[model samples]
Target: MGISAAGRAEFDQCRLIDQVLNRLGNAMAINRLIIAEGKDSTAVAAASDSLAEQNESYRRTKRQRAKAGCDGWQRD
Candidate 1:
């Protein structure tokens, strides 16, 4: 999106901040899911995967994971 070097740097910095905030929010949501769903790995994994799909960073960096192609947590 940014053309100039300084502009790109600023954009990256802001993007990093957004990513951090998004992860924090995801963590909170998963924490609540755990509290609600109990110690069920399957459900938690599914919820986390769903959250990852909704996250900009995860969607940008792990497109394959989004499609459940990787060996990581994925739904059937």
Candidate 2:
């Protein structure tokens, strides 16, 4: 069996929308972490750890947005 053209288009559009939403969610989470951790070193360190975990989670997302297609991974 094969997908119809319209079905394939819908799948692609859905995938793109999902990617955008995930990126937005990641950005919002990072922003909240920054705001909540703005005062203390301990909180900053904990946020650093949290960001590190998020970096791993969003590694592919970053690569997709990178200009050179490299992973372009970073700690911050």
**Weakest 10 consecutive residues of candidate 2 by summed lDDT:** 67-76
Which residue pairs clash in candidate 1?
none
Q: Rate the local accuracy (lDDT) of all candidates.
A: 0.59, 0.63
Q: Model 2 segments beyond 4 Å from truth?
A: 40-76
- For model 1 the TM-score comes to 0.41
Q: Candidate 1's C-alpha lDDT?
A: 0.59
**Clashing pairs counted in every model:** 0, 0
Question: Residue 5 of candidate 2: its Cα lDDT?
Answer: 100
Best by lDDT: 2
For all predictions, the C-alpha RMSD in Å is 11.9, 9.8
Q: What is the TM-score of each candidate against the true structure?
A: 0.41, 0.50
